[model samples]
Target: MFKSRRPGLVRRLWRSRVVTESDGHSGKLHRHEQRSMTHTDTAPGLTGEAGDLTEGAEREDEEQPDDDRGAMCVPEHRGSRRGQESDSRTVTCCLFGEWDFRPRSSYWAARKDGAGPCQCAPRRGVLEEDLASTAHAFLKRLKERSLDALVKAVETKGGIPGECVMVPNTELRLGAHHISPYYLLCKLFRWGDLPLSARLKPLCHCQSFGAVDSAKVCCNPHHYSRLCGPESPPPPYSLSRSDEHKPLDTGTSIGSVTSGGHRSHWCSVAYWEQRTRVGRLYPAYEPSLSIFYDLPQGTGLCLHGHHRHGGSSSSSVQQIRSKIGFGIVLSRELDGVWVYNRSQHPVFVHSPTLDPPSARGLNVKRVMPGFSLKVFDYECSSWMAEHSVKPESQEGPWDPHSVRISFAKGWGPCYSRQFITSCPCWLEVLLNNHR
Candidate 1:
């Protein structure tokens, strides 16, 4: 729980690892038992794994198909909310905004029942003339196949959870590049589009079809969780309304977020040198957001001081600091934590939310300049932890809640060096147990 605190106490906590924010009172620091980064001795360990820097470490990759009329239900009424009743047939397909976020593009127009939460904010409609006819046709075809999958299941005396309906992996073309069939289908039916290879899990009945780089896969929109994220959008997220408001622009408050009159922190941002902690812990709480940058700031995490590259002897302290540039801004929202790469260079990120459900693989994303990503999806994170895996390899480190990000350069087997300790500058985003 968090409450408005004496400014002095707030300042002290920011300047040091006060660890536990008070419930308008005081408490002790805790090393929460969450997943940790690899090379624990050399990496910035999480709560319970805390250790002073004796050394260094840190660091950190979808489809569809088609069918018939009895294959799907005919719409009687449209645009209703869940729990509220209507005369139309029940929607046997995915519905955007049902997955922890607001919808993107359009919603289920032919559905008989209402949709889910935080009803989407009014969005400006796209002009038909502006979009290619092929794009519209592709989307329409997708909807037909989505419901057709359900109809097949019902016909066989099975249900939405019965089987994976086959689909072309690259069925739709938008602009110059092709898009993942399931991704676009999910965007229209599941929810908003995401940047990271947001993994989609097939229902138990469709699990056999879940895999990477498959030429053919399931197209049942309801087969995948409505919470589907992107799977490397080489075509770009141009299809989603590009002008929509950004996560950083939200007016969420920072350290003063509260729950039951006590303070609650979503996560703590820590800058590091090899394994040594640099600066104070920047706790991003709910209702507000904060930034981690190299420049002076009235508030948020300002990464100052010099850092020496333990592994790379050629780079100097000034060079490492320069790499920070404007750094990134990490925000805590009711849905999850977001990171905006405000710096000039790309930042490599690894988080539990980035774990692909189908393969159980941990992906390190390369977030480029001026780009932002929902680094952690709270709902997804919780779901992953339930079926958590302890990856014991250099390519992966298991943590359903914690996140690690390396700046400027990258680490791991593909890079010149391995481990976050070799990274000149990096960050450890340790999520709070309470969140």
Candidate 2:
């Protein structure tokens, strides 16, 4: 009985173990099959579907005649290329067309800076006015011709016996000419006006005359006293003067002051005359209002000196600052100051009067090495102190009557060492009190 029971139990245990192992193997195979199916389904969702659609379309296209395919593709390719070219052309026009919208003054400024040719369109208002004037003149001439012809015809036909000769009327219509709108637009927008260079020629000639005359009279010592006479020697060129007043005509030889006793301020251009190692003077000329004097580098001192070392010690270390180039525009009504950076490094300008406090302080303007800036409507005296010091004051009274030009940074003065012992430069605007 024990032997039979032992054999049966051993058979059952072996069968159960074999069944469990088979079940585990089957479960792993099922999971792997599911993962493979999921990967295959998701991977082909969008890209594979699109590729299949494209292939089907391509097969259909291949079935069609080659000539038909070429004909269809040629136009599509040409259209795309033309569209790209048109977009490029539009971008170019947009870039250049902006100049046309700028003010006339801006155009002149850009020209002065030696910018590229301006693609600005003509002034619409001026074009319309010109066209209207031309049309009116033409119509007037036509009317006169028609009247003359009518009279001649009547005279040939024997003048009307008693009353009047009635001539046949002819209708005049501009539309009959069949003028193109494009042609008209082109005519109206064409830049046909004189250039800035051409307009400046006359003014430049006048200024040149003044500058030459002043140079001859001031530069030659023999001619100076003779031309100026014994009563008063030609006054030294100064940034500002108050002691002596000379008429503009006598002082500058450019323009005469108003006879009505109204005070008029004039802009002066002067060259620095080095008399000795420590002595220098300015000889001025009244430049034309329409022209600008380009102050070259290493030519004249542009700033006044602020003594770092006191007394005689300051003279030993006195140095002229870096070379600078700038321009000055002066007029009774309009004035401007412009700076052109001609150096390898940046420059800074500080004007207590012209610039706002925010800009005058540590936030001074940084003029890049090759850039320029135009400040309009500048007045030299506008920056002067409001209060005046009494001449009797023991302390060195502040000279409220001075033009100060200061530069914050640059090479210490070397070229102008013979003339100036300071860093900055100043000019005095002399008020002409002579009648």
Candidate 3:
């Protein structure tokens, strides 16, 4: 939980991860000159995955076709506070902010078949290492064909049409066989524009489509709406609009947004990394191989970090020596965490209870930059191998602790990389701290 402390060097240290404000002087003037060169130009509206794009305004109900009129009636009435499960018709999807962290287990017996938890410290490697053969093959195929061909194949498989109805296979969820096509469809369709994907089981709304006679079904418009309604947008977010606003000038290095500016939009970010445990893996602490995915060739992806507030009270410089989490959204007030894509898209991650000791910790905080992040947790990694094929396929002695990020020029663009790899920027930050 974050609370404002007194303004001083101590405060600055806590906010170091956040982006700085422009003082409205030379820093501001210089940024004004290079603003165009820095921030990526945003595309306002383009054809997205499976549905019509809704601009700033809500879609008009009058425009619905007779066949689709019954769709989304419930979602229209439902407020934003509700979770994804509430709407039977919808599948929750997010780019960043929500992190599905593995529950750290007590050390388990190492598998004799060389089956689980490799005994290597920082045991795992990057997603790239695990899928290097697969991804490389893909690259070669892309070059053999035209970019259009590559885009088409990715679109067909990943579902880039309408609302991005299909999730692209990247290093993250690659081996996750539980992924359902209907679930993917629900994620792709816009709640406001189409029928909720038919995958939802418990048929709650048989009446909307007219239930057959003799089958007395309680038509739940509530559940029906989720099955056929407007797709919910990711969460909305706000950058701090207060006087604490610091502008990021051209050369003013990028940092976290929650540092001290006014709150902007309210979208949640979700992070999905392969779960693994310590040692007995490639470079341990690196994300599992399945986390990596080749981005839709031309598209760009960006990683936004939200930093946590140090503490409520201010202390002397010596007090500033403590370490808080890295570029992640930290809030003392709201249980919900949100992230903003540089392209202006917002994602919302649900954090029900803040008991880190309890099972209900916020999902997004799992990979905090400087907190107790274990490069390799052997117990959890073993569990992941059980689900993957050729579990021992990834061999040893590879670099696995880099953060790979891809940036491009579109709003809501999807980028996929493994978190296990140590990114240059993160390494630099670590180096600076040591210095």
Candidate 4:
């Protein structure tokens, strides 16, 4: 079974592709793997041990058509929650995964890490009021155009993503930028940091922006996807504020982990200022919040102190502090941990689920202000932590249990802020073995 499986057998992770249905829609359903991917368990395995995974050892990309899976081309139909279908009901296929015919390979293939399928739920209060200025504006735009109803219909639909919803072909402006209404909706609802290189293509056999007879433009979030390309690497994670670099105190219970036992607390939390520890480590129990930041009300892990950069410029400190307004609230939910970004600026996250690295690189999960993302997978993390190759270090190729959140800044090859330590205000969320 994917879940409850033994770890330590590191695999190749993900490869993208699709098989045509031999029956009817064979020609329409072409493969969309773009030398790209998210995760996959059905991917082939390594010939040797994990360490032997080198460039030459990698295999060539090829499409394998599975008739059994393709036979599921018949989409089970039902009435959507918010509204009625446009013209034709959206097609949901087991092969086409979730987000509007997006291949399952584009999802987090947790089975690759000895975990279950991708059920990563969206963060709560995504469209509610109390968002940052930019986010509020986006929400207002959606509601104004009555596009929010369409998005909800797509999201809450029973089968595949609901049918396409469209808007005027003209550009929608937010602040100084002119943006595609559909692309922006996808960014808000589906992919948090939808890549700049990605362009919206209508679902296979669907019409273009205006080609649809009645629907001017297709606005369905899942109806479009980014062209296949290599994802950019995220910034490196740093632990300390001092010139002397120190590894993050990942709050590992070495004895419990090695002995295959459990920790006393649900998680151990720490607030960081550059490299300096803000205060004592906080232990979180059930029913209580795991970690929180600079909130207007009840506080837990608050961001304070200017150990380095912010200390120099009071105005800069205030500017950053303003961005940190309303901070974030992270809590342990059903089987995973969810983070709601209540701050004005975007929050960048890197956790086991977000960054499963094989040394090639990783994409740091970005949660825009007002939205949320499942930052940690508890079952997967606990299992990996107990069975990890290196139990002591939390900053391994991928630390399954701990999570890093950067406030307003993101670390990566793409951004100037390339390390977590360089980020002015950030938090280190280290989970305990509480499975």
Task: Go through the candidates in order and give each one's C-alpha lDDT.
Answer: 0.44, 0.25, 0.21, 0.42
Q: Which candidate number maximizes TM-score?
A: 1
Per-prediction TM-score, please? Answer: 0.41, 0.24, 0.17, 0.37
Q: Rank the candidates by lDDT, best first.
A: 1, 4, 2, 3
Across 276-336, the per-residue lDDT of candidate 2 in tens digits comes to 1222333233332211123322233343332223333232222212232232222221233
Report the error of model 3 at residue 391, Å. 44
Best lDDT goes to which candidate?
A: 1
What residue runs in model 3 are displaced by over 4 Å at the alpha carbon? 1-130, 141-326, 330-336, 339-435
Q: Which ten residues in a row have the lowest lDDT in candidate 2?
A: 220-229
> Compared with the true structure, what per-residue lDDT tens digits does model 1 show for residues 190-266?
33333223444343234322244456667544444321123332222222443211111222334444667887776
Tell me each candidate's RMSD, in Å, in order: 25.6, 39.1, 29.1, 23.2
Question: 23-61 in candidate 4: lDDT tens per residue?
Answer: 122322222211222222122121111112222111111
Candidate 4 clash pair list: 165-219, 234-412, 235-411, 235-412, 240-275, 241-275
Instruction: Please write out the lDDT profile of model 3 over residues 35-94, one tens digit for every residue.
Output: 111111111111122122222111121121211222211222122324454433221111
What's the CA error at residue 78 for candidate 2, in Å?
43
Residue 18, model 4: lDDT of 17
